[model samples]
Target: MAALRKAIQELKQLKEQCVEEQGVEMAALRETNQELQQQKQRCVEEKDKELAALLKENKTLKQEKQRCVEEKDAKTAALQKTNQELKQQKDRCAEEKAVKIAALRERNQELTQLKEHCVKEEAKMAALQTKNQELKQQKSRCVEEKDAEMAALLKENQTLKQEKERCVVEEVKVDKKEDVEVKVEPEVRHDVKMNALEIEQKLLRGNIEELNMKYGKLLKIHEKDKAEMAALRKTNQHLKQLKEPCVEEKDAEMAALQKTNQELKQEKLRFLEVKHFEIVVLHERNHELQQQKERCVEEKDAEIVASHERNQELEQQKERCVEEKDAEIVALHERNQELEQQKERCVEEKDAEIVALHERNQELEQQKERCVEEKDAEIVASHERNQELEQQKERCVEEKDAEIVALHERNQELEQQKERCVEEKDAEIVALHERNQELEQQKERCVEEKDAEIVALHERNLELEQQKERCVEEKDAEIVALHERNQELEQQKERCVEEKDAEIVALHERNQELEQQKERCVEEKDAEIAALLKKQLKKPPKALCVVKEELVEVKVELEVEQEVRVDQPEQTNEPIPTTQRRTTPRWRRVINSFYCIRPNVNDD
Candidate 1:
């Protein structure tokens, strides 16, 4: 019994020791649990702080991202605007090239017309020169013949003048003889011839009256003839003077015509030079256009590369965000598991020490509530950041619209410049025509003056002939000279007329040639226009392909973003235990309202 009692006492001691060890174990577990709870609380607080910091950082990142996105969108818009401007500039350049081609064609036509005009003018001038030479020979022959005729007439006039002087001397002797006869007769007829004498006296008085009337008539006739001869000589001299002036003017006009022709040739040369310049400019422009096309193609390739790289970057960022979200969700799941394990351990420990365990659980729950509130605040900040990004996108679109407007204005200015250039060309053509007409009028005036001079020379020849009757040798010589001069003038006039006819023929031929040249130029212009149109037809398809590719990239990016958002809820884990975390009636109602309202917002 003593041994059994000793064994029982040892057993009781061992049992008490086991109970003490169990208490120590429980105390240790409680201490560990308390430490774990504190650690969980600290972790929760740290997590909350980290989450708050993350939320704040995310808000800042979102704001920065919004700003970056706005800037990127602005850059994209600017690029698009630049692209649009480039396309417009290309189109304008193409139009300008077409216009230039048209202008060149017109210029070629004008040059051809000018060339034909020059050819006709040269032909006319040659014909005029031939006619002038022919007429000059005729005029020289006529002058020589007239000079011979004048010499003969002057000799005859000198003989007649000498005869008239001799007749005057003979008349004086007759008057003396008649006086002697009258004295002898008067003595014989003293008585018988007294009546006869009265009759004779009456006859003498009648004879005297008749002689006086005849003398007056002769004097008037001679004076009239002298005046007519003087007038004719003056007219002839005036005509000769006029003829000389006409010849001088004709020479001047010929020189002027030559100058004008030279000017026309210069104009043709200038036009040719301009055409060459235009061709060079066109070649340069074509090369530039080709370069521009290459640049556009390169830019398109770069844009495509950039788009692809951006897509890659966006995909990487999305993947990273998704992974981070997944990691966060996994962490939440691990935390929930840890919380469940702690709760299980606490429940088991609480069965042994219920009062202290309940108080500790209450403290843990209060800490959890504070962490959850902080998390909610962080979520609200993320939502606000998303709204800011959307506003930035809208602003970017507005900027793009503004850029488009600016490009349109620039295009309008280019069109106005084109119109002004056309107007200036028209004015230049008008001025050239006016100048040509003025030159023609001056030529007509010169011809009229020459004709007037010829008429005056004819009158001068008559005056010299009449004057030759009074003065013998001197008058005859002067008449001969005047007649020869008149003949020379007449010949000169005929020569000039022939020259003018030839000149007119040359002008007509030149005009016809000009017309042919114009036609050729027109044909060339038409060909150029056709070429430009054909080139324009080739450009549209390439631009469309580029635009289509950009649209496809945008579509793909949108779809990926949509998919990421759609998978967000399903991929996330439940962090709170449903049994332990009962939904507040107010929160449940608010959640229900939020779901209904959110769908309505989505629909709107």
Candidate 2:
């Protein structure tokens, strides 16, 4: 009865301790919640200011649109006055465009003639590029090999670090032992660890020495390459120096030739004049070739500088990659801290678990101390066994954790490699598909006997497309919930602003509709103008048709704008999300006006 009372008293004390801890944690959480609320309020205030700015921008955009409309009306009025003038200009433009096209066609013919000359130059450039590529490849191979070695060293360093840390922790545990004999086992283990670490450090020093030797060799090779490059630069400089005097001498000879040709022109009139002109063209081409040679020299110098920078960058990148791999191991300490924090949080959350854990820990500590004292005389043999088992369990757990982390890293690397492979293959596969499509199109055009095969292939493609669509649908369905959840959360965050801006959003919608209608009306009017201009140049314009077209354009714009204004406001009272806004047609019209009209300018 007395023992039961004592146990009950301990339980009460444990409960009290748990309550106190919970109270402290609750106070901390409340403070954190209050801080978060204040921050959120500040964010809301800032967002309100941003909303006001956006509203101002909206008004400015509206003003710009109105200005654009006014400008369009004025432009239309001026265009009516200048319609006759534009017809004359359009004829002049067409003639100019035709002459330009002919000139371009002649230029293409000239370029084709020049392609034969450039072929030899291109071959020479290819040879130079190949040489550069080979040198780059060699440097890349060296960098890759160095990176591999560095990675190996990094792994070794990490293992050594882990072992060193384990030893330190073991030393800390050993320090807590009361008995000298009990401490003796840990002390011996510590000595063995210290010896192992010293031996490993020695090995590391030897590896470092070997790496230094290799690095020295590499440096020597780099110096030799640098000397070769310097020699090449000197040779290029010498060539340039030689070419300058030769070019001057050629110019002198060409001037002398021109004097002779001019004298010959008196005897052989038109024929000599044409020959002289041909000679001048050849000289110009010679000058251009000389300029190209200079450009090539400058480009080669740039490439050499780039290669040097690239080599340095590669070395730095390799070092960073190795260091990053080593840095990953540092996260193990962070993970341990996170686990401790998680445990504290779990204890804070679950009073029963914390209380039970406290009870068990206290009971175990008491029993262990009491048992050690009581058992020492009775069964001193058990001490070493218990200590060994505990050490072995700890080591096993640590090894397993290390193995898991290593495996996870390996798995990630494999996944990344697989994704890269897939990406590379996808490009090739797409090219192959395009080639097949081209073949099919060619077959269809040629009325081939393999029509049956093509039909079968087409059917198969359709089936595959259907299957792809099904797969896409399934994937979309899976992804939609996740997207919807995210959107909902975002909407909830912005709901405060959204409610206040509902009227503004509705106004925006109406304005957007009006803008769309205005753009369409403008586009139709421009297209009508282009057509009218085309007609006026081709045939005399009918006054009745022109008047009807202008009236129709004005009425259409007015009706569309009025309809949009009436309908948009009623339906758009609820705030529409930015993401859900439809893409307006004005962008398409602008693109069409710029990109499409020019191509068809001479098509008619």
Candidate 3:
């Protein structure tokens, strides 16, 4: 740029020197007529030579201007291409950022879903824990109830053993009383009474045999019930044992899931942090790009202003050249006028020389006119080149402005997207909170139901205990009444021996009626025992079948749960409501135990 400026200054100086030299030559021509003609010839030759040199300079100047304009056009074209490429890159970057942002949004949504799943799993775990605690309590209660029942059974066994010993002693006493009664009988009636006594003894023996058979059957039924109970206990224990390991495994899996969740949370945090950093970097980059654009625009504006100054300078130079041409022409015309007057003064003596000089002058004037026309055309061409450069610069500026506007719009869209994402997250959080509250409510209701069921079981146990005590009292009263009757009969027999002959017929009638009553009572007891035995036989199999079915269902459910776990490793299905359902089997076992024990005690 400095070299070009220096060249323009030199050209200006040369043009000024040419103009001064032309003026000096014309002034000398005006001073002397004889010298004027020869000086005019010299001046004309020098002016022609100067005009040729000026034309060469103008051509060189035009060539330099053309080269400068071409270089500027090439630079502008290359800058525009670069700007186009940058805009494309910016557009691509914006598209990529949007795509990446959408992908991140999807990832965030997936993470939120995972988090919600984790929360639900945690809720399930909590429910399971509560269920497990309830089951443990139920197991403990069952065990305690079993222990109490066993103890009661043992006590009943001891009482039965004592009752058996008492009954054996009473039977021996009764045999002694019978011997005394037999010995005291009147001799006249001894044979007939012996026959009757023998018949009665035979009948009593048959009744005893039937009672023994029934007792044995009842014992067998009781043993079977015991065996069934033991089996149920074993199965219950087995189920619990299996559950323990499975529960442990579930706990371990839950822990692993929690760890994975934590890792995911950390990863999400890191990703968010990274994304935030990237956004910050992008903002910084945008700011830097803006600054760079501002600098480029300033530079372009400066370049345009410089181009305008160059155009003005070019116009001034063209005007100066035109003024210089006109001055030279005026000087030539004045010289011609002087020459014409001189020609007239020396007419007849040198007419040919004068005419030849006029012809030469005309040719020189034609050459000057040709040179001026060429220069004007060249000036016009340079002006057009400047205009083109200015237009190209304006286009580059407009394109840059459009890119900036597009960038701004893209940024606004991104910000709106961010706001929407935040709002969605807030809504999701609110939904999760509501879900958690619902789970809490469910848990509380479950606990209340369990407590209520426990109270009902306690009341049932108390009722059973009361019934057992009432049955014991009734059996004791009957035994006492039977013993009193036996003593009264012995007293009456002693009196009958003393008052014999008169009361003999009445006593025989009373004895026959008592024997008939004994037979009827034995038949009724046998019928009642048979009915009880049948009932006991009917009940246990149904209970056992139900228990077995329940166990099978539990095992099936466990398998299903395991399959669900395997299929969806990242998610968990809700556990079954076993807290309530599991109690059924335990209560069934309790009822079965009660049933098994009740019949034996009642039979005694």
**Most accurate candidate by TM-score:** 3
User: lDDT scores for all predictions?
Assistant: 0.55, 0.57, 0.56
Which structure is stronger by lDDT: 2 or 3? 2
Per-prediction TM-score, please? 0.25, 0.20, 0.29
Q: Which has the higher TM-score value, candidate number 1 or candidate number 2? A: 1
lDDT tens digits by residue: candidate 1, 59-90: 86567556544644564566447655644644
What does candidate 3's lDDT look like per residue over 91-117, in tens digits?
554464455445434434443443443
Clashing residue pairs, backbone N/CA/C < 3 A, model 3: none
Which residues of candidate 2, in runs, are more than 4 Å off? 1-129, 140-159, 171-195, 223-227, 251-255, 258-604
Ranking by TM-score: 3, 1, 2
User: For model 3, how many clashes?
Assistant: 0
Off by over 4 Å in 3: 1-32, 183-604
Q: Give the worst 10-residue stretch by lDDT in candidate 3.
A: 565-574
